[model samples]
Target chain A: MSRTLSNPPSVELLSAVSTFLINDIAPQVNGQSAFHIKVACNILNIVAREIENGADLNESVCEALSNILSDQKTGSDEAQDLQSLKAELSEVIKNDQIKNNAELLDALKMLTLKQLAIDNPKYSGYHQALKSNER
Target chain B: MNAPTDTLIDNSLSGYLERLQTCCRKHFGSQVEVQNLSKLSGGASAETRRFILSDPNKRSSSAVILRTSSIQQGAEFSTSISKDCEAQIQKLCRSKGVPVPEIYFCLEEDDQLGEGYAMSCVEGETIPPKILRKDQYATARENMTDQCAQILANIHKIKPNDTTISLEDQSPLIQLEKLEQLYRQYNQLSPIFELAFKFLYKNAPKKHEITLVHGDFRNGNLVVNEQGIKSVLDWELCHWGDPIEDLGWLCVNAWCFGSELPVGGFGSMDALLERYSYYSGQQVDLEQVKYWQLFGTLRWGIICLFQLNCFLTGLNRSLELAAIGRRVSEVEIDLINLMEAL
Candidate 1:
């Protein structure tokens, strides 16, 4: 990839704006406006994290999905993308086609953990799951 | 009660005030003034407005809350009971020693206020963060588990046959089917939800004693004071189901609000079940509660998706709703953890 002319990277720029909203603007607001400002800051942070790690995480998710669905016969040849693979997995699960498959469960867990890593790493469930994984 | 400031009562709200004044007169049987009529935030299924109803002749005023259905013609997405039924349920619960706001009147179609009810506004802090963390509510945090258990017991004592209002019978499998249908309507793929559905199906417990479940009974729906929970609010999602569902739904991690304690961030599951067993006169099966906890997790995830759809479809373009879309992952992780425990 060719280097684009940029002093501050996208992640850094987002973090700077989020800091401005939280440190400077949030203290001045109250009630619903204050709450919305907090949410706005959170959204900015999520965007920054996604920009920094989303592609790599999604690539891992794709690999896990492929490992889980490799042996299972897909419905059609067109169902090869990430979205289709996920939809296929959902369908199979709903139909009880894949029951008590340890590999499938592990894959799903990894996929959800990766998603939570980007969406909300601070969520209590994420931390609990991480602790349980370590154990 | 103080009257609303001039700036608080904008020009757009004058018509609402006039109509509310008329409604107050009919209910109070006197010329009552509706002051400080302001909309309360955070309810998605219904509109809640707080106001001071003053009878000029008596020179006395009291805080009153008006709740009306927010559902419009093309936006029938809520699974809540009717506003009239909700009011009746509250009245019934109050009669059964449950701490709920006193219902004053249910709005009729003739009132032109749509479907709603007026009730006495119970004064207390309803925010979960305040109730869980504030020093004033430290006692409340201590007593909440028992208080909630007692309230749930009282609420569950009311049978469907006891009320004139029609309540849906949502057994475990029936509720799961409805949830799956609702999720399918969104046309979104969520493998974690699917896995949850599968787990719930495989582990579906035998139908226990069917009783009225406060479908949305959780932290945010409670009003707490220094002593403890003063009133239980938001009975819009009440239905007939397994009594344990209430206990399980209360333990959902999302309602914990970043707190480690499971039961609404105030107490442990053992304490809740112990208190509930004493009040309800039956030993609750912990395993059953776990099943519903998993169900509640998936239910919250689907609701987050529903909110995101509302934002995506332009029905409600709220920053809060857009942010809630990202919260589905939190529920996903919670589901994974709960399933692992199972």
Candidate 2:
């Protein structure tokens, strides 16, 4: 898969920029401008992390969602893409067909955990969830 | 008085100050002076500015807050009531012995300061982290959960029949339906939101006696000091609904601001509920509160989504709103945790 280019370099560049903003630029600015700079750095950090982990993350999410859709009695037996699979899951949940089902809850937990892992890994709840699951 | 810097004083603020001076003359005297007119950092809903109004001849002065709706963040979401309506509600809440600031003047059309009112400024810390973590507020933090409960109980006592301000008497089920519709309007799908919507829809609380709910009853919104809560602020979302809605919103983990405490980063839910039942003379329903807690979390998450949508849709191009949109995932985490516990 390594041709003539790669993404890590770009992500590293973003990280460098975020580090510069946090260490150098933020301490100099004041008020709303400083706040915006901090948020910009945070957004950069999230984007960089996403670029690093997005593919594996999406694949795992698709697998979890597919597992939920294939539940025996209440599940849909269609082979579909990630978007359609997600749409189907949303429909069944919205229609109250799988409301509070144990399998649905598990699927939801996985999906949420995956989301937090990429979206906000440092969130205290995410860490707490990870800790509790470890035991 | 600190003089405003030449660079700091801009055109619109100068014009706004002139208009405020004109408005003040009617209450004070023709020679009324407004000093230290500066912006205060707070919520995006309203523009809060602090100033001192003095009449040298009378030798009297008062610190007042002049609040106006920001042209950018104007009521794009459904929850926000008009500033005039908020002023009316605050007046009624004050009359009924609720801990809210005193409204001094409601801006008229001739005043041209847009939609907002002036009120007596109550001094205290409104920043959530400062109250949650700072040593200066140690005593206040210890007593806050009880104070919040008493405040919520007092707020719930405001009768719909007594106030001229219109408050919506909608059921929790109806509110959930409205939220679903609003979520659809965003036209972006999140499996997390979908799952949350499903859970909340299936377990929406039954309607109780509809009373005034301080729609933003949480930590950062409370004005606290060494004594305790000074006043409850931000009535923009106040409405006539299930009073338990307020209790649930107060305990939402987002309002907890990363603190382990369930009630506004201050104390336990059991303590809050116990005090609320005692103060209001009604037994609390823990199950109903839990249902609303999930609803409130999703509701706050949807609000983050809406703020992001506002930025994306070019309605209000604000960095803060965009960053807040990123916080939806945080709520997703909280929602999952709450559901697992249930």
Candidate 3:
């Protein structure tokens, strides 16, 4: 975990590739190809962000899920994984098993914010959410 | 004028143009010519093209838009109406004084152009970013909210009985139910979506006056000129539902394109509601519109998933479609914000 590879990391490599596509290749192309290159650049950026923040975000989500499940007295004995916890939480919400739970709402908002941070930090709602969080 | 053999005019496009020329000749007389037929940026449901139709005898030429169903018929989830029906609805909406394009003719099966229609093209900018950022549209931006409100009022004024085409009437709860069903079909779990579904089901607005909803009415769909809105395009999603649905859809953050203004990045919600009330003569409910805004946000997220499913399932291997999957998180954040506000 300390140092598997030296010099440029995955994030740096992805960033370099995205930069190359957008700055170098984009202007050379036109129309649909140009548009797609931009999209490819964006996707690369997202992947880079995911690589950087995905583990921490998932850990935070798992912690939030654990907190919510325990608060609702619905925590399972099997030491559920992130996907299973999310599925359980979804079912809980779907069945209206939890009502007016401020903690649950906050956790969901945090989860969504963390996701937006990875997927598209530039999205207006993500920026707005971050601004509001500051207040 | 003969069709130009430019690089843009590929074999398939040339063949399409030839068939279109024959179709136009049948309607506009033997001397009618089709020129500058180029594909326009369009949604998955339809192929949109712009061309000039000229009548040599009359020495008259007109810009026209040809909107045809994708020949291969890709899975378009929201498009409930056929292209023929869409044309009929546009004609009906025009009769009701809605600012839509003038339909020239609906293509028959024999034309081999697939199901589609040709309409007189109204020139304007439809791109949201340009309209939102450009200084040329400053005055238009000021007036667009009012124009959108009035146009939506006019659109809602057209009663279901007035139109020959059948518009499916789905109440808010029913719409939510259908959306949930569609979301379940993909079998992807998002706790945010689940929470949204729960909130929507609990607080679903009671069905008020059902009217013709311009299902995709937003900043990007409106054709904006220097003066104001020239036309409303993309009627494929039009249906009978809560009239406020259109107003809420207009306010969706995705449509705002990073603008602070909730109403299509042009004006405030209060202004939109006031103008809508003035035009439609119906007092607007702020809560109802907010409900639909939240609903629209969730609906858009599900649509992103659907688009991703299309890519993942190998139905349409489009990078854009795959990229849309990332956009679902944008909607999720918007949904969270909307719910917190409510």
Winning candidate number (DockQ): 1
Error of 2 at B23 (Å): 1.1
lDDT winner: 3
Query: How far is B61's C-alpha from truth in model 1 (Å)?
Result: 1.3
Residue B206, model 2, lDDT? 55
Which is the winner by lDDT between candidate 2 and candidate 3?
3
Worst 10 residues of 3 chain B by lDDT: B1-10
lDDT of each: 0.83, 0.79, 0.85
- Models ranked on lDDT: 3, 1, 2
Order by TM-score, highest first: 3, 1, 2
Error of 1 at A134 (Å): 1.3
| Residue-level error in angstroms, candidate 3, position B94 | 1.1
Tens-digit per-residue lDDT, A1-135, candidate 3: 123285688778888888888889988977668768878888898888787788888888888888887777655656667988888888888877885567777878888888888898888999898888898
**Tens digit per residue, CA lDDT, model 2, B102-200:** 998889989988889999999888778778888889999899988888888888887788777887776888888888888888866677688788777
How large is the i-RMS for each model, in angstroms?
Answer: 4.8, 5.2, 5.3
Where does candidate 3 clash, by residue pair?
none
Q: Rank the candidates by DockQ, best first.
A: 1, 3, 2
**DockQ, all candidates in order:** 0.58, 0.44, 0.57
By summed lDDT, which 10 consecutive residues of candidate 2 chain B come out lowest?
B1-10
Cα error, residue B150 of model 2, in Å, equals: 0.6
